[model samples]
Target: MLKKIYPLVFFISLYSYAQTSVNFTDNFSGIESVLYNPANIADSFYKVDINILSSSTTTGNTYSTVKPLTILKDNKFGLNDLDVFKKISSLDATIDTIFKISKLKDLDSYVSKKEFSEDSNFYGNSTILGPSFLWTVNNYNTVGFTTAIRFNGYAYNFNSELYNQFTEKTYLNNPKKLLDNNFGNLTGYGQAFAWYEVGFTYAGVPIHTPTEFFKVGVSLKFLRGIKTYSFLLNDFTSNFSLNEDVPEDSVLDFNGSVSVSSSDTGANYGQGLDIGIVYEKRNKTLPINNIDKHGNIYYSKAPYSFKISASITDIGFISFNNIKTQTNNVDLNLANSNFAISDYLSIGSNKNQKETYLLPTTGHLNFDYNLNNHWYLNTNLDVYLFSKDRINAMKTVSNISFTPRYESQHISAFLPLSINNFGIYKAGFGIKTGLFYAGSSSVLTNLTNLSKEGDFFIGLKIPIYNSKVVSEYKKGIRKYSLLKIIENIDEEENTDSEL
Candidate 1:
């Protein structure tokens, strides 16, 4: 039975990635910002933004301080190659030697040496943003289309004994006491979900005044579920009666209840929605709107002194059909039966089931303060709204983040710091030059072994910026009427017309 769950644990480790990127808040992020807050597209710098491709991944753990990637790196060199190891330094060689010794003699070598809580937890997510675009429709409206493949999974409150048993397998060699009357009582739950989604977004400025500005945005998404798997352990008990004369005749009795469900490889459809609103107090009044000769509207810049925004995202579920569900409820003795414990549990029963798994619905709040035209400070808070008690549901780790950035028309740099609910701190940095950007939430820690989490994100895009910034600013004014722009939509115009 434990063997059946090994793949799920391994999958969690390999697919672990940060939930969101810090660069998503950049002013020039364009379509990428829509994922964090759709309202971010309002008053964007781009006339049109086309995202070619983007990907982000992360690695983290609560019980282990040793970095997984570093261990893999050290494992590449053989200890017998003393010359290669000595080339680094005496300290480096000593550290590598200790790690190799642990790996050779201990099955649980990777487990942390520090004391851990009785119940442990881990969360992971991955995203690949596909081709997407954002288009400024007019002075007050912006629209966008996005497509992505995403994965979310989590394990919560796993007891230390259960975690050790699953992560390590050391059978009873001498068989003195295989089980006791007070043994085999544990409970934990975990789930993993993957999907592909296409989304449409609309953002509009409903109120634009001299000091106060307000914008609202909404996204409607269609989802196709790729895979769904979950397991729950309610109660398990085992007792063994040893046969000293003939060790093979030992008997083990078991009585427990559990449920395992998974969907086959097939299409499952669903829908999702995200809505957000932003309000800003302009540092310099928003520049009056201008229309190109081709009727393309321009705002020139985001002139906010300070702004606040809130959003709700992933509010939907997917219904997976042709699911395989196995529920256990039995009392059996291994010696009395011809089959092993795992074979008995595996052959119990199977029924076709249909289940609906909810997306990792979350809420976000953001506050941004501008120091000047080129520098800004931002803070964000993310929270999960769904119930964690449900074993089949998906969820993201809630976190609070602060980022400071230096941004210009052509280049930008930012540093982001975030802390999860479990108090794990992560520091990261990013750089954006023209249409390309890359960053990581665990960059600082990845260089050291002090932290257990890491992340990396990169993207390429084609951005058509506002042609120019005017010498003088004006508010609540437009050079062309909205009605006149309709006629120009079909006409060819200069893409490089000055703002």
Candidate 2:
């Protein structure tokens, strides 16, 4: 059933632009570790953080100019020119009737009559809203967990115009001919994706020295995505009426119309893993200045600490259920014989078909250093690896996102600070480059493009305790009550013994 509707679905997919930037702020998979180190979370019980990002880009145009009907015509006729008899074979009678008035003598006429005036000056903007929570176990051994939800949405619109011009004499000779089909309107292509993940990490192994730490974490995620496309056509007319060659009564004039709509909802599921390690020299001796009141030398020592850690994140796959639908009219004769459109323009046929595919899995690597608890800096690199078909199948139509699955990478460095005892703040900058693997795969091939780089992120973190905090507080209360009871009993015993 899906095979019958694949072509229509494929056409819709072609119009969608699914490529998005993977900058420092856009790294949802790394949020847990970046906001709360395992040791910190374990000591504090848990941490909560939220990050928001906005980015924009103007890209160059890169679409081939070929009329839809021309391609179909060539495939059907197997003819190089209109002069060949085979060129008209199997053409629908309605289309053939319109073709009879044309002065188009060859394939070149049809090709040249339409201009490929597509420009790449494409503009896109995106915003990401993310919130996460990380929990810790205890001081000696810390178990941390985090759940982050990220929302990413963006839109791309194009200014495309199609015009046809023919000699006035040709219009006079064939009054039924179309001289101009100039039509232009806004074409909408937008995407929205929501990523929700819950992850847990265990750090500060009891067996490790006081200064050394290691952690491992895993995340299970639920991904929901919604994409919409709006395509409008306008300003279509026949040249015969404009030429005034045919009698008013004999002229057949046609007005242009357009169809605008949205596609189906997209949803998926994904999972990932993250692991980290931190080693610190908590007891370092520094040569101290020797000073005496009268210039005599007395040596004193100072303490120093240094720490380093690394982590990997977002290492899993997202599976997609092919919940595809079309908002425009489907030509039953071309694909499915049973396809029919109701009065409301709803597809009443083949409603039970569903397709399934996989979205690309993305990953990241991070390294950080803490200098004496007052200052810290970290660097992160991320990559997206997938095939072309895998990406295309998941995209909405009218999207011009040309990101193909190859291998794209990004890097950033930031400085984080502890605010009092309850909060932490960080600000940093980064860059992204390469277009190895980006977006859905069906539209393009193994293609590579110039890399793009961008800025860093600014974020804050606060503690949010898990069950451990309540448990610890309860334990303290119980101990205090027990101590009071023992005291009372001792007092009673003393009085009785004294009596």
Candidate 3:
């Protein structure tokens, strides 16, 4: 009965996610820079960074589609909007599209044109960094603290029928193909939840020599899980007929866990850790008296030509107590039936034991080059270390970005060109002036009506030092690759790293 009438039931309130601050890759990165690499706190130019307020949101999917017309006159408008179901179903476009697709398989494959499963996954994170601080304790060390509300969610391994149908738009014509068992097996699972987290970090440039320099950083975090829902399918198979005369029997081997707690009742706590290392080349022969290498005593702020860094972060788990779990087996045989689905699986007996949930641990790789005094290019790659098949697991983010920027004492701007592992191609711009920064991951998508996926971020920061000139501003990016320029610089006997 649930399968016969599922088309009329519009599940508009599902799907959510957000990513890290991809735009904070410049001289004015401020306090939030530690979110990427804790060691950055030691390398940044600012003596101190006080974060005022910062927030981010992201929503995108591969299985379903949302008609992108704004809902006005008492309708919910955004991804996190409260009254999602009513607002989503109110649009005529949404209703017609739903009716035409007419089945679960067709509905699942409504968005993409080809290479279906490659994009039929899920990801989302929402973070609000509040009252964060990063202070340079000395010329070579830095300490920082941050608190934020973070939510993560993901879905993957959907049915192959949708992939076959949507690959050619045949699902739209023959809705029965959406029900054909010959289409292949079905397996999909997803989970979403929110948590509160607080973190402390220490980073420093602890080692220096004639040939190399090294920086190390570590962070510790505390987390409190608020709520969670894990939807799963272990060998699940179902079949239903659109024709009333042809009765159908669908069976499923499913299990699920859902837990909830208000602010007053939520007491689940856990810990996470992050460690990073950085390596850079040092000025071998040419050195300045009080600046480069000569007059250095306790701590000297010397510059390096190139650097590479790596970190494994978020190694921890949250423990939710007083939870329940179930193994559900359903056998639905119906003839000429159409009824609304109130609920399918019931919760098991209350289990007071504590259940642990792991954080979506991440691996980071970074590269920075000083092309010239004022010109630089930075690259960062963020990867999730876990597989999506795990229940209640956070999906990994696979994105590689290159940012080129011009920097001055109080102002800077950059362009980020990114190619995401999930086939999302986007470009965005960011600018920082003294105490603030703003940017979006996909600027052009936010402006157009056909936009499918988008995200925006903004933050405020206060730099401690107010110097008239940016530190060790490089000259040009082209000189690093040109052999003639290096030869000319050697002929001139200029040992300024680049020249």
Q: Please provide, for model 3 over 277-311, each residue's C-alpha lDDT reduced to its tens digit, 9 standing for 90 to 100.
A: 88877444323212434433321233457778888
The 0-to-1 C-alpha lDDT of every candidate, in the order given, reads 0.69, 0.33, 0.60
Model 1 lDDT-worst window of ten: 471-480
The true-structure Cα RMSD of candidate 1 reads 11.4
Candidate 1 is scored at a TM of 0.77
- Alpha carbon deviation, residue 56, candidate 1 (Å): 2.3
Candidate 3 to native Cα RMSD, angstroms: 7.1
- Can you give the lDDT of residue 376 in candidate 2? 35
User: Where does candidate 3 clash, by residue pair?
Assistant: 17-124, 17-125, 18-124, 18-125, 372-474, 372-475, 373-473, 373-474, 373-475, 374-474
lDDT of 2 by residue, 266-367 (tens): 555555554444444432121122233555211101111333443444445444443333344322111223433442233322222333333323344444
Residue 21 in model 2: lDDT: 25
Best by lDDT: 1
- Compared with the true structure, model 2 gives a TM-score of 0.37
Task: Return the TM-score for each candidate structure.
Answer: 0.77, 0.37, 0.73
